[model samples]
Target: MDIRQLSYFVAVYEQGSVSAAARLCCVAQPSLSAALRQLEQELGVTLFARLPKGVTPTEDGEKLYGHAGRLLSQLQSLKASFSQPVARVKFRLGLIRALGVERMSQLLREFSNNVQGLELHLVEPDEHCDARIITPQLLKAGEAFQPFWHDSYLLAMPPGTPLSLQAEVHLADFEQLPLIKRTPCDAWNTLYPELVRRGIKADVRADIQTIEYALGLVSAGVGCALVPNFDTLLQRQDIVLRPIVQLKLERQLGLAYRKNQTSASLTVLRQLCQPVP
Candidate 1:
């Protein structure tokens, strides 16, 4: 009946679960559920058939999905027309910030050329996205993930630092190591417990957010930081990268979406993301 309800319906239909849709929409699960219930009451039809794992579209739900998708697309196009003469198909994608600058830049360039009229929005922490290119660790329940290109985390420090002579670093090497804390990183958090268990306390120097800043701090000799191996970093003479023998944190980057749900633009992206030989 209303735009909000229609949007909620579309999210639930695509996500196949109210909880998953709530996360994608950055809303509380209860609020999203209440909206769907109210919409179902107003329309006099059940939109979804609930299951133990997740929800599936009912016959009525499938019918509404078509109309709602088109309607939302039109509204988005209308909004875009004011900014640019040509209205583009919007595709909101969630990208993890930990993925370094080189990879992100390359992906954007490659994707734009492949998908025409692609209005890509990199929504993170707050995932208001049709599809997400995040690691498996961050994926929602029941979402099918197709792994693409990715890399591992490494100990990044300025040249001639204390442990630079060692070809392979270990948890024991971290004692007295000054570290930049990149907060709210799931991968970093996973490595934290192991460091604690090994009695390797990070000589906390900088508490930063973005990976770019973390790298910048590393370059400045402020402190060493754990950064993804890929980056314009490989080429940078200022920084040296060494693998942690004990904890090799490799990121499984991929296309995460509901299989068969086929978000219009993301369906094409899914095909493009197939692991190549």
Candidate 2:
């Protein structure tokens, strides 16, 4: 429930014996055992399974072990940060929209699960921020960009479309193909001009901004759409995403932060960045 209780719990978990953990913590055996009981009651989780010899941590205890260690470490670090009572650290993190829902959710779950005593502010890319997950172009002067992952742009077509039969879509294949035009996309900017230069008149079906909605149109048999080959889209049974042959288009995304400023919160923010599964 508190720092002392967590310390005792960690000791008991690691030592695997109540009497030994109590001795290590310099507390009486009954008092340390009582503290563990109170912590378990407060958390509503059975932290340890008692045996004749020693204790074994339950699945719930194993899950809480890492959080307890980090929280204790975080508290220890705060001792050098200030001489008084510590308050929650607020972190402002900006993110661009339409990074696949599944990937973004996984990244955020890692951020939320690992750390305590921190508050998060999620906002748009251009807003005021401590750090932002975005592409390099959004980097301002004196800001540093650390590249993380790249997403490929592919043509999304409704199920059973004749073009979906092709192994890889070509530029000429887009000629007169009913299309869902996703605007403000860099890949579209490059691919559309070439389509225009070749005198390929794309059958423009719809003009939309967000890729999430564009995928829906593709599923409904409205038309083919050009979208980043996000896992959520590529794996969907209702739509097919095919990379354009000989035209390599990818969007690189990463973290951007002030050049010379590194706070504890920024370090924690950077640690949360993970590879897409």
Candidate 3:
């Protein structure tokens, strides 16, 4: 019925007797017993079977014990979020492979330095999911998430692969080479249709996991790859990246948390990942 009742119920279940629960709760035995009795009355179910040796939880009591434990844990977390200092706020950030580890790491370091109470957890979903880490459904649901950047995809090739010197690479030319395709997703649906229009079939040479792995294969002359234009990879001498003309490939990057909750720590993180004008 209430947090206190749940706490008392859990304590009795753990200690196996009201007297023991009272000692653990720092309350009188009679008070603990009364709380348990009141809880059972409110719920209209017998909770524990009384015995001389100890009280054992009945079927209903066992079920309530599990639910009450979870409820109390969540309550404790909620209490901590408000009562604890700002530096204790926990964050979970999801990223695609193309965001570039070096760039993301730098952003995280800067954020940590600026925000005292911040704890950030970063996840790369490319290893598991076929879709881009950030989906339209996730955004449209008005989920407590915000997009920071949507990077246009680039073509990575071995040095001197002779891609056109144009500002953007056309899908027609992509058909001419052995393409190392990233996994198929709705994000690239437009580009795939354009490829079909041009009468060019993608010669998918490999289906690699992450952009880095695909780039490694590209650098080794396995096949060309489409990747994010993270400046760190551009510095590598063995690989050359050109803007993919006409393909217009891009991936969105963002942060998510529970809605309507303002977090100073999250704001600091967003500033770190802000794109330069």
Among the numbered candidates, top lDDT falls to: 2
TM-score of each: 0.63, 0.66, 0.56
Provide the lDDT at 254 for model 1: 86
Which stretches in model 1 have alpha-carbon errors above 4 Å? 1-87
Assess each prediction's global lDDT (C-alpha) against the native. Answer: 0.78, 0.81, 0.68
Look at candidate 3 and give me any clashing residue pairs: 87-117, 168-245, 169-244, 169-245, 170-245
lDDT of 3: 0.68
Candidate 2 lDDT, tens digit per residue, 189-274? Answer: 88888888889999999999998789899999999988886643443567887889867778888888999987876776677664
Per-residue alpha-carbon lDDT of model 3 for 123-174, expressed as tens digits? 6643332112354344533345556666776777887667735555667776
**If ranked by lDDT, best first, what sequence of candidates would result?**
2, 1, 3
- CA displacement after TM-score superposition, residue 125 of candidate 2 (Å): 0.9
Candidate 1, residues 9-90: lDDT per residue as tens digits? 9877766668868986789999999999999999899998877657777889989999998999899778767865645888
User: For candidate 1, what is the lDDT?
Assistant: 0.78
